[model samples]
Target: MHIQNVRKWCREFAEGHTNVHDEAGCGRPSVLEKPVTKVLFADRYVIVREIAKLIGDVSKTNLDKILTDIFNYNKACVWWVPQMLTDEHKKKLMESGPTHTSPAPRRISLPNSVGKPLNNHTALTWLPVTTSFQNLYCVLQ
Candidate 1:
């Protein structure tokens, strides 16, 4: 918490304001669920910022809460899609599996350095241009 807020709270406590929570209707009122839902449904690819622009006086955080808590939506590939996946959708994915399949990744073997100690220079020579750390670690071990 900010020092100023802490000091203010301490002052309030000193003044016999015992309650820790804010008074009723203290912060901004919650954004209406209907408008948010309409905006989201209108454009599945709409971002939080765009929603805020359309619905005046709503913060990004509050917008996120409305999308998740109220509508049960989640951001997926820049689109605000429904969180729950129906059985039909799952079945469709299963049916389309073969079309999405790609060839298996080819593995390259390191040079034989059996007698010599594995050093950075020797390791670099055998490492593929696009090698990842996980693969590099496995080769070192």
Candidate 2:
């Protein structure tokens, strides 16, 4: 405890306050894990604000804490996925391929003519970009 808190508690005790524990309705309200987990699992793309709206009586900060600290969830692309993949999740990911795990395939659109508007002759092309899953390896290893 902080020194200030200790001094204050000592003074309270000197004044004959026998209660050592905190009184009721003190500090942050508790958030239930089951409801939060259910909402999260129901929609992988759900944001904190949406969760707050659905859950009610819960702050975004508390939701974030529940997600990261309690559940070990992390934002991967637009999806909320587990920070640490279990053996089953890993197997599914491997079988489904990396593309399945990604929210969308990265692509770069290239116009043949930068300044000119597209006509019958103007060609637009998209180059598929590959992202390395190096971060996953770092975490998993």
Candidate 3:
């Protein structure tokens, strides 16, 4: 609290105003509600700092709270599809389709003494397989 505020409260108490609570216009009211709503409607993925820049006066922390509490909007995921996808890219994805299967697992030929032929089963035994080289490297402790 400000020293001026403390002194004013003390004066009020001495002058018979027993209520310690402040009067109606103690602090500035929030000016964020409209600006936040407008920006969100324009682009839902806008960053909080970007919105603060647009508003100019609002702090990022205050704007963030207003967004969460009053607007009830969480930050969007950045991992989704890119903003612009070329037609060629879309066509390629469509051709690939949802059920694209990986190539057939190639067999890994190891020395007979080691064990059975290693394929995807090597992954189960906590071994890494180099598919391009078609080989398995065993790690010795």
Which candidate has the top score in TM-score? 3
Pick out the ten consecutive residues of candidate 2 with the lowest summed lDDT.
108-117
Model 2 steric clash pairs: none
Off by over 4 Å in 2: 1-31, 78-141
Tens digits of per-residue lDDT, candidate 1, 29-112, equal: 665788887786666546788889998898999887777775665653211111233455445434534444663322222233
TM-score of each: 0.35, 0.38, 0.38
lDDT by candidate, in order shown: 0.54, 0.55, 0.53
Candidate 1 vs 3: which has more TM-score: 3
lDDT of 2 by residue, 41-124 (tens): 666556788889999988899888877776766664412122344566556445544364565322211222122222223232
CA displacement after TM-score superposition, residue 67 of candidate 1 (Å): 0.7
Q: Scored by Cα lDDT, where does model 1 land? A: 0.54
Query: Candidate 1 at residue 42, lDDT?
Result: 67
Task: Order the numbered candidates by lDDT, best leading.
Answer: 2, 1, 3
Superposed Cα deviation of residue 15, candidate 2 (Å): 27
Higher-lDDT candidate among 1 and 3? Answer: 1
Task: Indicate which candidate wins on lDDT.
Answer: 2
Residue 39 deviation, candidate 3, in Å?
Answer: 0.9
- Candidate 1 scores a C-alpha RMSD against the true structure in Å of 18.9
